[model samples]
Target chain A: MSDYSSEDSETEFVLYRNNPEWKDVTPVKQDDGEEPVVAIDYTEAFWQYRREILKGLNKDLNIELDFIHKVILRQSKNYQVWHHRRVLVEWLKDPSKEKYLTELVLAKDAKNYHAWQHRQWVIKTFNLFEGELEYIDSLLLDDVRNNSAWNQRYFVINNTTGFTEEVLNREIDYTLFNTKDVTENESAWNYLRGLLLHDKGGLSKNKKVTEFCENLYKSGNHSPFLLAVLVDMCCEQINEGGGDSVYNLDRARTLCNELITKYDTIRAKYWQYMLDGIEKRPKRARVKRLLRAQIKHMDS
Target chain B: MFTSETMPSLKFVPELHKKYLLFILNGKLPNLESMETNRTVLMYFALAGLDILDEIENIPPERKESIIKWIYSLQVVNEEENISGFLGSTNLITKENRGKNSPYKWAHIANTYSCLLSLLILGDDLSRVNRKAIITSLKTLQLPIGSFKGAKEGVEDDMRFVFCAACICYILDDWSGMDVELMVQFIMKCISYDGGVGQGPELESHSGSTFCAMASLALSDNLHRLTKAQFTGLRRWLLCRFDAGFSGRPNKPIDTCYSFWTGGALKILNAYQFIEDPNNDQFVLMTQDKYGGFSKWVNTVPDPMHTYFGLAGLSLMNISGLNKMFCELNTTRRVHDCLKKIQEKWK
Candidate 1:
């Protein structure tokens, strides 16, 4: 029997330095004294030898997982550590505990990209899509601005039920309700736009969504995201070339003007670019025309 | 001590920033242990940061030669495993197992990209690079899904590696290393509903991944693969990211690095001119450390990565006293031109 102790818990974990089996191994310290810029101490051989020893001893999978968990606690963003964890989970063939591990890491740092990626992989590979929506909802409830949660919600919906007509309606309603609470919440607005994209006729075809935006606009909500979506719907309407093409074009132009002059002034140049495109004028001509109009308006 | 009121001035301070990079290049800071795995990337940032500051000549020629040699020593050309690229550090290869075929010693795509650019920045000719071996090995890293793994043993394959692969092939003046059509398809699939690209399919649309995808497409001459609507959508998505500096995702805090990632993507899309430059410049400058370098956010300790990208973000705005950067390759114009000449010779 290898000297590896199976009784070790997470807190009482033994490192290579304390382990009697690894005492003979002369661990290479990083040559930071010589090379200041690129002194990487651990080599592939070091890790390979450790893995070989673990495999040779027929060590419990929990020990390896605990060791990785300890390392991840310190270096949550390390790609290699997360990759090793994934490999071990696959070997263990039970992903039941993986989500909990990722959750613990994420609870510490919500935007830790590696943790999120690993969670997504475990959830997808093991078909553990159940309750993922509730998990996402809890994350968003904690912080509605967590874009990662919003993205995971999209991922779960797409992979499981998909964006069926019924699913789309439900998502639209959910996203609309959230948008009403925080009209400036870009994530919720982006989510709504994502749902509308799944519709056959694009943003303009979603009468329900258009009505939502119109109601919000009429109610004195001038959030840049809200106006941006309305402008997109109007442009779609103009492109589809129905009886309301003229009205839609006029509304789109007015919204673009408002976006530039009043709301969304930070992105004024983009709004101007949109206006130029709507008028189908050359860029230089559009710029010159805008300059002339601004001068005329200022003089008047 | 470095509040806005006490901020020195709204100046680029190339000298102070260059001093910080030199400290990174010549001096050993104890805090760099966390960056041991990414030593090559750290070196690239220092060297490239100096080049951007127009102070590459500060490094004596002998030191430059030694650095060049060090970079070349990390190259692995194993024909059996079809692995040809640069490792991040020599710590992975001990004397006993040196030159042996081990999965752990596989060359990494990101390391290779950084090493190649570092070589050109140091004025090394392309004679030492094993073009054939590297390109041959690069072909094996591509997956059927058109994305690329970082190495032969790498489990994580994403847009970052795809970008690195594109940079490697483009720098070597070869396209046989990857399947451009499939790669383009993969990038297209990564376009999230928000119109920004992500690390992979169904992932969150992030500024860094969007930059990687768009820059890869541009480098591979596959920009035309995007439909007109997709192009417009991408432009809108990029333009919408600007709030003070920029954010990787919606509702995220404005970070200094996104100034380059999102700004670099906009530069490629011809939409960078639309950004409110003064606000971005002020935001980046506010994050400048009083000692030297820029941090990810104001009041944070500055690191080499954020410092290099802060300079890069300014370089995109054509900041005074800074060298013009070729945003696609993330190197200076002079080095890019040198690379172009090397490619011309290859043809």
Candidate 2:
């Protein structure tokens, strides 16, 4: 049992009694003579009372959940209302309706943070990851760049226990297939990396992975997200020192320089910072000096 | 329907804006009726607006005392709960329950931060601040994972409250309340793969949380903890936020708020020079209404949040006639100057 009455000590103030939005409804007299009855709509007053109760953190369980549902319907973005709902769901031990509640809330605003957070809680508490991939797929079909949906997809895959090599490979293929036509979609690109990171074959050693990236690069799609990923892969390879020589670092630097000077002007300073980090690595010190001389000659 | 020559030229209305803020502070705003719990935050906006206009001296003497007293009334001085931070508003506190025994009273980290800042801005000596109790209360709100919930009974832990807790500690000149290493670890985990920080691990990266995390790091003096590669990634992600104005995330529409969120983050990272000043200024200017405030975008209603951020964005760009902002703290130079004096007194 929780202490609910003590929290409700702030209920001395009146609410919705003087709100101008609502008026006392008058009932029309029946044709046959009878006493005139008053018609009252208590929606605003009821909501006002519920809001005050929720604000005080009163735990009435079922009533609190109903209040939260109504509050969310009107203002889906209110964090406090959703937080109260989360507390209620945890206490009630029945999160079965949470999935549907989240779906309803998110139907109003797909990117509602509280709704997404609630859905994540539901998925974890109920192990509802089996059908999540398809749900994410439908959301992505509606808009490929829905990062919230992409984040959910990532959450489901990474947090759930069923992520096998087969699942990861299929996820990679899904990203590639969905992103084939878009010039630059950072969500799909990040998803590709997320999936690849989980693959046991590793990012650079995977034949399909390398081929997929090389083909995208060769197609003149110099997207910043794509270039950034490719450059990272090359740096990882050079750091491994698998007989590519220090020239591999030089090529990677060139790619980053191109990213700085040409394609991604927005992130030029970031590329420069990355380039400086590359030159300062202890392993690359010898080759970095030589590259500096080469750059000086080119500048001259 | 009108010709180009007949269109009214838009301009910032400083005096009318001051009056608008004062009107909101008078507690009679019908438009703000729903925000009863967040009246102190609204007070911050009004006070910050006046501070920006260099008109803080215009507050009448009695009004200043009442405002200070009102802020103190929202504080929870109870010893049993060990929660002695400021509540968001006194609307929840009634005449019948005005003592230390009121069970309805609660303190929020955000309200504490705002209360402290408002006091500092109003030139109060902060003698009334319960430094030890507030610090202890802050520690109780911290999770073992280094994040902070807003209050004891509030929602999940995230970067927003972490920033608020950091600000509270910074204002009190105390770092003992928080576990610095754990907080740093939490912040690092919040850094998304794309380099922009999220509210928490696995959440979508957002500009607001990125600002909060960066500000927290800056306040804690732990920004150097980020590796060279990590710093570059963060700088890259933040710079890429610019698309005419800025968006909180990768695919969202440009909003006026991210101008401050992303811009403040970039400034803290020391990469603000890359911001396209002219385009950003134009975008922010587009959100200005003839009525003396800035909205989230053109053709929308203006609110205190957007207005404050819009002014802050311009100030970041070295716009004339606006107060210079302390990027990490998100306060004006005047307020920071007052805080510096308070620090000197403490020393």
Candidate 3:
């Protein structure tokens, strides 16, 4: 951010002053040029570089061996850098090779959204299949609350190809025991619920999530943000395609009341009305009407 | 890869305006606690970006009308008061005490350029903007040596404002903001041994300021306006920027915003057509969160300003599912439509 202000100090040599002068870049390393070469024009060298870039990107191999990383690092904002990288990645489509490369990329920038996105791209496009709970466990060991890792965990268990009830059950056990705080517990709940929603292998899993949520409600720091997530998740279960009308409704209404008494925020209030809106009960209807009136005359 | 379906939430919003204005109400105009202090300034893009996307919902229509009306009120009407239609950076009208909080009572070329762009983006009729005042302001800002100052006041003159003045005059169908001959000479001077133009002649070429210099010429109806050597050099400099997102200069990390800043420059140079499309979309869209909003660099916080530019970069490719927003002006393709309208109405 401070670099934005560094504009004033460098008054001399204008733009890119004191930066490295570009050399006459050849398309290749010149496989056998042993003799001393003459100085070449930068513009011509630039053309050669672009020609090479296009060539590298246009390779027919299933997986390109082009060094797109080196190219993207040069001019960071151009469309060509992104275009070339994608082309090169598409060129490198061997599933076994791509899976190995994904691990290398994750190691290089553990939080690189682009690299991670590219790995997902490789998997989705190439049909690479693997179990990830063991890998996810290692990430949690480093930082249980790592948001991207949590997101990746969710992506894998829910979106990926290989998963079983046993593996996911293993996940619930690890997440329940290893997580240090309540946020992690809530996060684990969210991830596990995603699996249950997808029904990977159709083993009843939300029972584990249901048990965890029950425990968390009894004793855990409930931030409104998290509480909001809790209400939504509950609403999902209640609103399931063919849920138990009696059980889910009673639980939703009772929990909504519990949430309203515990959290006095607007979102909580709205969710309370929504849960109550499940049925046109006299008290709930009256409150909903009053809230709407207040909202209508909001400024007042 | 291009669809908005991957997003956890997909909804059109013109919500940031109220949030930003409320910050001013709270005496947090800079809103250091919030990331987008530049909103009041960049609303030109935000409002316009939304307009281009055709997603100006969440803002009540009547209130949106009033905000556009107020933004129009800030335009420098003419040269009589030594004012112009170039928009002032932040015009805070608090508690009936109007103009008390305006940082400086002058038109900033950059803000003015952006303000008109926002107006155009929000589908404002351009009749309210007084072209002469903005042109006068531009004329007043340009120094004798070919550089332009930010405002009419004794201010630091540089290439950024030169771009702003050029944009205002271009949109307004006027060129009073610049002495084109001297402007060209200054740009020529800024050209280093490499083709890229810097803040000034003898300055190093930077992707950011270089956009200003190049786009200034392009909008001025002077794409072939530079010396032959300068033109070729500009081409060379732009070609060097084929990195992941387009860095401002060498050894800088690629960020999403530059995709438009430099990508637009190449488009203006007629060089953008040379680059392929899918890579650009995948790159810029990578900045977008699966949940919401776009970030600057990868794995960074998402905010309004970069979101605007990130979308603009995609729009440059005419990517589906987004309004086509010009990277520099940040208005819809309707600016060219407006230009055609002006030509039709006047011709």
Question: Best-fitting candidate, measured by TM-score?
Answer: 1
TM-score each candidate: 0.90, 0.83, 0.47
Docking class of 2: incorrect
Residue A269: error of model 3 in Å? Answer: 60
Candidate 3, residues B41-157, lDDT tens digits: the string is: 545544555654556565566656766765665555544656565443222223343432233346666667766766665556677776666676678777888888765543445
Residue by residue across B1-347, what tens digits does model 2's lDDT show? 12225545445556666666666566355545455566678788878877877777878877787788777767787667877889766544554566454654668788889889888878888898888888988888999989999877645678999999989888899998899889999999988766678888878889999999999999999999999768867887788788767788888888888889999999999998865434457677778777667789788987877877887887887777778888778788888888888889888
Please tell me the TM-score of chain B in candidate 1 relative to the true structure's chain B: 0.95
Q: What lDDT does each candidate get?
A: 0.83, 0.75, 0.54
lDDT per residue as tens, model 1, A69-176:
777777787777788788788879989778898999989987777888898899999999999999988888898888888989999999999999999999998888
Record all residue pairs in model 1 with backbone atoms less than 3 Å apart, i.e. clashing. none
**Model 2 Cα displacement at A110 (Å)?**
1.8
RMSD of each: 6.6, 9.2, 23.5
True lDDT of residue A158, candidate 2: 76
Weakest ten-residue segment in model 3 chain B by summed lDDT: B28-37
Per-residue alpha-carbon lDDT of candidate 2 for residues A1-300, written as tens digits (9 for 90 to 100): 001222234655333345444347443221211211111111112223444576588656786676567667766776766776776777788887788888887777778877888788778877877787787888899889888898888788777654587887777778888877874887788777767767775556667777777788888878888788777776666656521542266767888999888987656766777677666663575577689999999999
What's the distance in Å from true for residue B214, model 3?
1.5
Model 2 bad stretches (over 4 Å) = A1-64, A162-164, A199-206, A234-262, A272-284, A287-300, B1-19, B58-62, B154-156
Residue B347 displacement in candidate 2 (angstroms): 3.4
For the second chain, the TM-scores of the candidates in order are 0.95, 0.94, 0.80
